[model samples]
Target: MNRFQAMAQIMAILCEGDRIRKGSQKYKIARKLIAAKIDRMGPEAAYSKAKWNKYELFVEIEELLKAEKAGKILRNYI
Candidate 1:
């Protein structure tokens, strides 16, 4: 999934429950995205054998989303 979609999923989880703190939002989203990808790729596909990973990609997105100055929620909005 794209970064926006990934972020959307994380936001949804954030609003879903108090059990999950915002600090773990990235991990939650990464797990969810990986599961979704595995589903789309078919059950035969295994994450262990995958050549790429989402956590690294999410790290890049997090850096981009960091505020350069005064900003809240989203840094760059389309």
Candidate 2:
């Protein structure tokens, strides 16, 4: 993928629910961006970047999943 796509994929993986605040509108938007990028790059490639360990990426995926779950229940809109 290109640089923008690459960065988007990385951001999508690295972001956490706590960072976005689960109940906020930002959380809902971030969740969608994460899902789209993860779908394009595949979760493995999206989370695993240079110098990052597999376990770390795995943790990121877990966090993304949590964000996804929280986003589903959240009703806020941008």
Candidate 3:
């Protein structure tokens, strides 16, 4: 199996494990973190490839990664 094969979409993005742009990586404390993939993104007709304004990324990843799957990935992205 490939690396992301076992990881939740949100988990892989979190552990992109590399340096990334500001908005995609870190965020302000008050605002809830979110991850979404844009498709045909350059046009006004573009839409989300991955659920947006939904994942709500968190700080604690270890716990969340173990328990994350199905529709529960969001609540546990911590």
- Which candidate, 2 or 3, has the higher TM-score? 2
Worst 10 residues of 1 by lDDT: 69-78
Ranking by lDDT: 2, 1, 3
| Candidate 3 ranges with C-alpha deviation above 4 Å | 1-6, 17-51, 59-78
Q: Is candidate 2 or candidate 3 better by lDDT?
A: 2
The residue pairs in collision within model 3 are 60-78, 61-78
| Each candidate: RMSD | 9.2, 10.7, 11.9
**Per-residue alpha-carbon lDDT of candidate 1 for residues 1-78, written as tens digits (9 for 90 to 100):** 554454455444433544334666544544454456455664334233233443454554354345322354431321
Per-residue alpha-carbon lDDT of model 2 for 50-69, expressed as tens digits? 12653454454455556656
lDDT of each: 0.44, 0.51, 0.31
Candidate 3, 1-78: lDDT as tens digits: 222332244334444544223344233211222222221232121112222422343333323433443336543332
Candidate 2: residue pairs that collide? none
Provide the TM-score for each candidate, comma-separated. 0.33, 0.39, 0.19
- Ranked by TM-score, the better of candidates 1 and 2 is 2
Model 3 CA lDDT for position 34: 24
- Top model by lDDT, which number? 2
What TM value does model 2 have? 0.39
- Model 2 backbone overlap count: 0
